[model samples]
Target: MLFLQNKKFSFSILFLLLLLTFQPLSSSQQLKKNVEFNTSKKDHCQKQISASLLFDITLHGFLLWASMGFLMPVGILVIRMSNREQCGRRLKFYFYIHTILQILSVLLVTAGAVMSIKKFNNAFNNNHQRIGIGLYGMIWLQALIGIVRPKRGSRTRSLWFFIHWMLGTAVSLLGVFNVYSGLFAYHEKTSRRIRIWTIIFTVEISLISFFYLFQDKLEYIQKQGVILGSDLVTSTDQGLSPNDKQKELPTDPC
Candidate 1:
């Protein structure tokens, strides 16, 4: 009887041990499946979020690049080329075009900036953001300066002109750099291809730069060959000795 009771108790304990071990195995398997399912769902949601982010980034990039890269430079170029036009109406037309384009560019930049703030909810978090903010400020300031241009011969006109020119040039250069930074950021965030865009942008910049240099050098070269003949000779003669004046007579007009 004692042996039978001991055997019964050992069997009961063994059964409980088996139950506990086997139950946990099953529960652990179910838990693992649940976790995997949850992980998969999370991954799917993340993918959706990434897609939306990429779209926003691309849109922002387009707006920024269009404003800074294309519109601003082209507007400035139009103004510069128009200055050489002798027709007042034509010059005015180009000036109006430049103003319109610049305004459009500013609008685009403002849109981009609003979008950024809406999406990111933070500013100056990075170099790109800081530079972009500065660029926008400078661009608006430049536009204001242009609008309030001083009279041509005012005492402050020269200072204003220099300030405007320097500020504009700095903004343009900084804007180009910011565009590149934006491209880099876009690629880093989206892992998208940037080589084609980079190449195209580089080519565009090269063409613009070439045209600007050509215009500048062409003007300089033309001026170099200009013979202001009689007027220049007479101007020089006023400072010369009589013998020097006589010697210059053949080259001068009476």
Candidate 2:
């Protein structure tokens, strides 16, 4: 069931991308004429602000949140797979999805960032441009890490892994803040659906992240013959099981 759901989501995102890409292109001529008509010396700055506002509110806000919603869980899965003691069909599936999702996420972010930068390069003191470059670099570095994560048991690999996690987390949190600021900048003036959907997507991604944080703990408790019900909780004073004792796990993802 989870597999099916993920497949459906992947298709939906692809469809959405296609629609958004083509629809805008189809109307570009009309949009260009409209912009020219609205162009005047007195209103030049206003036009830039309006363009920036539209890109930030529409593309950076909702689309960014939604992309994170779909990508973060897959990313967590990729890391989990790298740490797993045994590989199986599920791990392979996760690898495939993770790679594909990472690429798609980069593409989506690139499109949005390009639109924002082109629309408001000078008006915003290049804040948007800087973010665009930073985000691009982070995403590419993450992709490179994913490609090499299987061999990351080495010292260099471990170093890259740490860097990857730090930068990835920074980018994700920055994206969240950027979206929030965009929303606040247009509060009560933007579409109600955009606000509501962004909130819903954020909450959903956060919950998934929380669950990912407990993956190791859950595995340890299960290996110790404890059921994964509400009854299980970690105790600092208690000794870990032999299975868990051999494994030095890091802190939770959350």
Candidate 3:
């Protein structure tokens, strides 16, 4: 009987040890399950973040290039051809294309400016945004000025032409600056390509305008015995003519 009692006591102790060991293992398995659940949730969140980034890039990238290439140039062309006298009567078809392209360009640019603000308001700031806003306002005002279509003979119309010309030139210069800033900021392969082409075109146009027009004027003044060089080029004020109050030729738009 005493031997039987010892066996029962040993069996009870063994059973208790087994129960304690199994309880801890069960709790560890539950903790592992919780960790796995949290890991899956984190992965899902990361995927969502990636998807949002992709969407913004796809939409904004398309509009950015489209406005730069198509709209700004069209705006300039529209202003240049606003007068039928400038373009002969038979070239009206070309003017029509010019008008249509200008309208489309303005619409696209307006839309793009708004979308850019929506997406990148925080990212783009300083002179870049100010220039863009100024360009947008100037282009819209230019379009309005275009509708009046000034007649060269009328003094009032001539004054209006001066105003339109100044505004148009301002907008064009600001647009070019804005494009330069954008390309610099991005510096992607596409932006670099545009930067190279822009620099080449700007240099070509500048050289042509300086030599063909300004040089001829300078030579004519030189023949009249007026020495000319960088000083005349840097002059801020337009000095009065020999007849100080005489009206310049109506042919000069500015």
Top model number, TM-score? 1
Model 3: CA > 4 A from native = 1-65, 68-70, 74-88, 188-254
- Candidate 1 residue spans exceeding 4 A from truth: 1-34, 121-125, 151-155, 219-254
**lDDT of all predictions:** 0.87, 0.66, 0.64
Rank candidates, TM-score, best first. Answer: 1, 2, 3
TM-scores, one per candidate: 0.71, 0.56, 0.55
**Cα lDDT, model 2, residue 158:** 68
lDDT of 2 by residue, 230-252 (tens): 23545531557766865766667
Lowest-scoring 10 consecutive residues by lDDT in candidate 1? 222-231
Distance (Å) between predicted and true CA of 94, model 2? Answer: 2.1
Q: Number of the top candidate by lDDT?
A: 1
lDDT of 3: 0.64
Off by over 4 Å in 2: 1-57, 125-133, 145-155, 188-195, 224-254
For model 2, give the 10-residue run with minimal summed lDDT.
228-237
Residue 133 C-alpha lDDT in model 1: 79
Of models 2 and 3, which has the larger lDDT?
2
For candidate 3, what is the total of clashing residue pairs? 0
Model 1 per-residue lDDT tens digits across residues 121-180: 454777898998788788888889989988767999999988987997898899889999
